[model samples]
Every structure is written in structure tokens, then in C-alpha cells.
Target: MAKAFKVPHTLTLLFGMMIIAMLATWIVPQGFFQTFINDANREVVIPGTFSLVEERQYLTPWELLTAVPRAFAAAQDIIFFVFIVGGVLAIARRTGTVDALIGRLLKKHSDKPQKLIFMVIFFFSLASGAIGTAGEYIPFVLILVGLCKAMRLDAMTAVGMTVAGYGVGYGASAFNPFTVLIAQGIAEVPLYSGWWLRAVIILPFILIAFHHVWTYAKKVIADPNQSLVADLPCPLEGKEATVYPELNGRHRMILGTFLATIVIAIYGISQHGWYLYELGACFVGWGLVITVLGRLKFDEAAESFIEGVKDLTTTAVLIGVARGIALILEDGQILHSIVNGLSMPLSHVPAAISAVGMLVIQTILNLFVPSGSGQAFVTMPLMAPLSDLVGVPRQVAVLAYQFGDGFSNMIVPTNAVLMGIIGIAGVPYDRWFRFCMPLLGKLMLFATIVLVLAVVFGYGADLEVASVFINNAGVVS
Candidate 1:
């Protein structure tokens, strides 16, 4: 008998969330956190400073329609970046450079392809863990798809190697200034203080995730029909998988140019605080350089680049739709209420339970507040004091926030980066969720265990021997 199957379209799911957010405005009391820029120019929530705010306008049928376009306006930067990067990658592929490189590499590793898979996983993890390169790698997903197809694997495997790997490493980040730094500051702990411990906790979890992906990859290789998208026409379908081509001089030049530009982009990010636009410019520049060197006709180059953009146009629109959920929550002034509701109960729990509770709360809150820095501004000040009263280490609280904010992006529809990456790969959100659910469970369980250990061992700054009471008057020594 054929099994029952149902999974909502990604846009349908996102629209459902927007409807819920609209209803929430009417049901949940509208509240706001008064925020001010700190000395570091970061906006932080003031503990005990939340107050009921008047709703500017209740969500109406028309507002729901406008919210999507407004969200698209808000996300123009990221959208343009996606278009440019997609175009560049398409141009490169059209040049036959990527195919040539893969042909050579796969021919050499045909017997031990798992070795190559593991290497890709580790490299992606390191980039995300060490430098906070989560969303920046979306363009690389297509390249990974190319690699996976060449190995007779599926697109989900490419996602596991790139998106999932990035999420795991990013969630278990050691020194990501965007998440760890802001969280440490608001939690009143030294920045990067818990790097050694974070590394110890995260590395093992990432290894487990890698093994999980590799196992599925091997299974799909053994039986192609077992792949999740076996019925759909995959981008890599019908491609020449066994043709081995020698890497000619033109291929080497293109590859070298792209690799060197990536290094430069990394340096720009680390040293100059670059973001999407700058990174997108790098890809555009590389594309132009390769086109000129390869001496492609203008029409040919433009056609290839436009085809790439066409392939990813759906993804770009989905990103805007996903952003609409967060947009509505913010405009409704109910985001703070959601955070307050989730965190208020931790005060009564035991110290260990409270720490774990923060992780659970943050995980849920990430659905509404997907931005790491934005969530930090909204939740950290309150969480820090709550940790103090319950004798949970400030660092443990930060870890909970880190794990919640980073890892949940792997599955959250509100997260445009996740949606965008998977959309580009042509994997539906439900299918991707089914594949990553088991691994996400493992990561969360491991995170909870780590939080328990942190509390048991007094992770990070020592809890003050003197009770730091938090009441109506605020923190008391």
C-alpha cells in the first residue's frame, strides 16, 4: 500500500506563521523593551524596563498584504546579495570550470569519497565556528550540489555538508562576535572567555552530525532511488557523473582567482567588519574577472548569469516572505511579550533546570526573533539577572542563548538564510526538516547535557557567594 504523505509548501507555511503573528497582536498584550545604544554601539535591553506599549495599528487584512512588500524592502540588501552571488556562481559553472575541477578531484577520490565528504563537512564547520560565516555560504550551496551530484549523492547531502554543518558549528560557536560577543557583554562575562570549553563541547557534536550525514550519503549512493528527491527532477539529474576531465590551464586560472577572492573576502570580514554587500561585490568582481580571462562573448556571459538568477528568483521571494513573520511580530509590538512570557518562569526552577529552561526558551524565541544580535538585545539583560538569582553561571546562560539562536536556524522558517539556502538547492522545507530532525534532536540533547554540566561545574564567571537578589527594585548585592 502507498503510505500517506503530506507536507506544506514553504510559502504556505510561512504565510501560516504570519497569520498567527497577526492574531497574536490581538491576543497578546502589546509590550516593548526600552533600548539604548551602549558604549560599544550595541543596543541592549534594560532589565526590569519592559512596559506595555500602545499598538500603533492592529493587523488587518490589508496589513498582511503590505507586510510582505515591506519585508522585501527591509531585506533588499540580502536579496541583492543573493542575486549577485547566484549570478556569479552560474557564470562560473557555465564556464565549465567547476565541472572540470570536480571531475579531476572525484576521479582521484572515487574509491574513498567519504574522505572528501568529511573534509567538506569539517571545512564548513570550521568556517562557521571560528569566524561566524553562517549566511555567507549560501552561494556555495550550488557548488556543493555540484560536488555531491558528481559523487552520485543527493542535494540533501550537499545541504548536510554545507547548511547543516554551518548551523551546527555556528550554534556551537567558540568566538562568534555577533552572537558570543554580544551575549557575553549583556551577560556581563568576559568576551571569548569560554572558548576552550565551547570548543570542547561543540567539536564532538559536529563530529556526530558529520557521521550522520555521511551515513545517509552512503545509503543514497548504494540506492539512488532511496534519495529524498528521487521523484523530482534534481538540478544534478542526468549530468555526466563518470566523465573525468584533466584540469586544463583555463580551469586552474578560474579556480585560483575564485579561491584567492574568497580569502580576500574572509580578511575583509575579519578586519573591516564587512557584510553582505561587500561579500556580494567580491563575487561579482570575481565573476567579471573570470569572464574577461575566459574571453566569453557578452551575450553568452549575460545569458548564463541571467539563467542563474532565474533559478534562484523563487528563493529570493521566499526569503522576503519568511522575513514577513518577524516584521509582523515587531510591528505588533508583541515580540517582547513573547520573550517575557517564555523567560519569566525560570526564576522558580532549580539552578540547573533554570539554565536548561533558558535554552528551551531561547530555542522557542528564535522562531520569532531569528536575528542573533536582535535576540541578544531583547533577552540577555533579563536572562543575566535571572541567572544570578538562580545561581546559574552567566556563561551558561549565554551558551543556552547561543545554542538556541544558532542551531534552530537549521529548521526555523522565519530564518531567511536557511530558507534561502534550501530553496536554492530545490529541497522543500518539509523534506529538509525530516532529514535534519534526527540530527537536530541530537544537537539539542547534547546542548542540554552541556548546560547541565556548566551549571554543575559553575561554568564561566563564578556565581557570587553573596546572593544577588532580583526583585521590584532591581539587582541587589
Candidate 2:
């Protein structure tokens, strides 16, 4: 009899990627990009600074073994932030705020399933576009999963809505500090130069996402057997909420603090340049406030927080390991080579095709460099010069970068936020892949069109009015 091949767990798969990266260090050419601090005071690579490293430093077995710990250290901010969100959310659940909110949401939109999906997709996308939120949605996964179960939908529907919104919002990010703003700063364009186009584009992409998710959700609702996750055990299998708790003054107060914390976090991120540390502190403060108002005994609140963190142990591991993949590639001294090699072709292509090629390169690189800001830093400098050579505006290059980074984020195994969110929802990586691939394809198609149109219409009017294709020999034609 033939044996069935079970897909590896996310952790195993990430470790395998790390091993590949380590091996690439030995096989791939060693190279590095010279860096300088730009006007933004950010370390950015100087154009034409890429060169072969004089000495090849191959990472040894000990380094591979230690990459995980190094990655944990590098990713601690995000890891701790995720834990804080989870713990505080768990406290809210214990206080019945989660259930009460779910009950109210379901009461308002359960029978109106399309409305619920649209709201989730729209609001999630809006947050991502506006504030660059990604892993922040992890706290919503289980809540959405339980709510979907009560509505006779699968967990895939829940995650699909969350991830689609995140992905599309990022692809069409207007004011996203993490991706768009950083890319713009690195690209040396005026801040938010093409905001109107990005703002208008997100709506259509959101519709595309909403339609894709709603199609799958409708099929699953009509026939549970058709669910992509039919065989996987439902997270809320036995505890389906038939009766949702009513929101009393206490529950309402707790939920109010939740919203207030989010508002304050947004203000801080936009006005004061807040990040994981501040966001985590805000959530912790919210947890204490809820504990007081929800009237959870000190022990109960503590237990709830502990249990929440305990549940996310796998999630934490996934996020940390995912970071290691990039670390291995970086330590190998091949990351710049990968970027250079991938981009070499664009110089030979036409302007419109070059724009698309930039998108494609960014998409592939996202698998290795998953962080939005990190990808921006690594690619934008190289791409900015390359865009001038290939008849692509520097601004369009930034747009393509955002498209590649944001859209692929939904499916890239190396993306810690995607893995963390699915891990919490109890969805297997393969299952999430199966469910998200179509949506990703649809979004990518729309993104391709947008990139092409941007190239045709001169989307970034403020920068690079003259785009001339140049050859490697520095001859412009």
C-alpha cells in the first residue's frame, strides 16, 4: 500500500526553509550592498554599491542551530506584543466581553452574512491601510472563528476574512507607516505623494477580496462537506455558542476600554511614532482596566492571562522560527545577491513590463524578507535606481514593492503575522494555503493591473517624469 504524505507542521516547514537558506550561503555567491544614512536618517543602500564580498563566510552547523535563538531575540518585540494582545484578549473573554461583543455582532449581522463578511474585510483592510496593522489581527482570529461557527461557517471563513483584508489593505496602503510611508521615505518621494490613487484602489481590491471570501463562505454554508477545512477539527467544535451573553454595563465598559486603547494606539503610532512596545503597553493597561471593571478576581485575571499566553506558545514558536529563515539568508551574505540577481532582468525590460517585473521580484523576495519595512529598506534603494534605468518611475517602484510585500504576505510561509494568526485559529498551514491561494491570485491579478496602469498613466507624477530604459553598459535608448 502506498503511504499518505502528511504535510509538515509550520515549524518543521520553517526549519526546512532555514536549512535551505544556510545551504544557499555555501552555494550562492557572497555579496553585500554598501549603505549610507539617507535624509530620513535611515540606513539605506547607496545605488551602485553592490559588490562581491572579499571573503565568503559560510554559516556552520552551530550557526544554524543558534539561528532560532537569534531569531527569537530579533523577533522578541513582535513576540511579546502578540502575547500581550492574546493575554489581554483572553481576559476580555473571561469577562464575557468577547462573547457579548460577538453576540451583539451576530445579532446584527449573522443572518446578513454578506454584510458581516464585508464589514470584517472592509474594517480590517481599513486598519491595515491606515495604520499598517497586521499581526494585530491575531487577537481577532479565535473570536472570529467562534462567531463563524455559531453562524454555521468554518474557521477558514474567519481567517479568510481577516487575512484577505490585511493583504489587500497592504497592497493598497495609502498611509501605512510600516510599508507605504517607509518605502516612500526610502524612495525619496514626497511623503504620501500618490495617496489619492492608493485610497481609491483599496475599495476595488476590498471588493475583490470580499467576493472571493464570500464565494467560499457561501459554498461551505450550503454544504459543509465542501469546506476546505472539513476534515480539520473545528476550534469551537463542542462549545458552539447557541446563546450569546448580553452586554451589560460591565461588559460594555470592558469593550469600551478595548476601543479606547485602539484609538490611543493609533494616535500614538501616527503622531508619536509608536511601535510594538507602546502598543503592548497599551494592551496591558487595557487588561488591568478590564480586570477592575469586569470584576475578575485577581487570581482569575492572572489565570486568564496565563492561559492565553499558554495557548499561543505554538504561535510564538512559529513567529520566532519564521524570523530565522531571513536571519539564515542574511548571515549567509547572500541576501543582497538574491536581490541583485532577481532585479537584474528588469533593466532589460520595457517600462510597463518592468513595473510588473518589479512587482514579481518583490513578491518572490517577500518569501525571504517578510517584514514590510525590512523589505522596503532592502529593495527600495536598489529599486529606486533600477527604476530610473528601466523607464519605471521611482514612485511606481515603491507601489510595486508595496503590492509585492502586502499581497504575498497573505500566502508567504515566512510571514510571521500570517503564521501567527492561523496558528492561533488552529488552522494548518497547508489548509490556510489552500484557502488563501485563490484569493491571493485574484488580488495579485488586480495588483498587476494597477501596476501596469500606474506605469501607463505616470502614477507618480511628482517624481521621475523622464523614464528611459538603460542597458548594463550605461547606454540609454
Report the Cα lDDT for residue 88, model 2: 85
Q: In candidate 2, what are the lDDT values of residues 178-198, reduced to their tens digit?
A: 899889988878888889989
Question: Local error of candidate 2 at 120, Å?
Answer: 1.1
Give the range of the ten consecutive residues with the poorest summed lDDT in model 2.
464-473
lDDT of each: 0.83, 0.87
Per-residue error (Å), model 1, residue 305: 0.9
On lDDT, the leading prediction is 2
TM-score of candidate 2 to 2 decimals: 0.94
User: What value does the lDDT take at residue 180 in candidate 2?
Assistant: 91
User: Candidate 1 on 1-477: residue-level lDDT in tens?
Assistant: 997876778888888889989998888988877788888787777788888875445779788889999999988878888888888877887778878877887778867868877787777877888888877888778777877787788888888777767787778889887788889988877788878888887778778788888888989999998898777677655543456467889989999998898899999999999988899889889989989877787788899889888888989988899899999988888888888888889989899999989998988999988888888888999999998888888889899999998888788888878887888888988889888888889889888999998889877744343233333346653
Reference-based TM-score of each model: 0.94, 0.94
Poorest stretch of ten by lDDT in candidate 1: 463-472
For candidate 2, what is the total of clashing residue pairs?
0
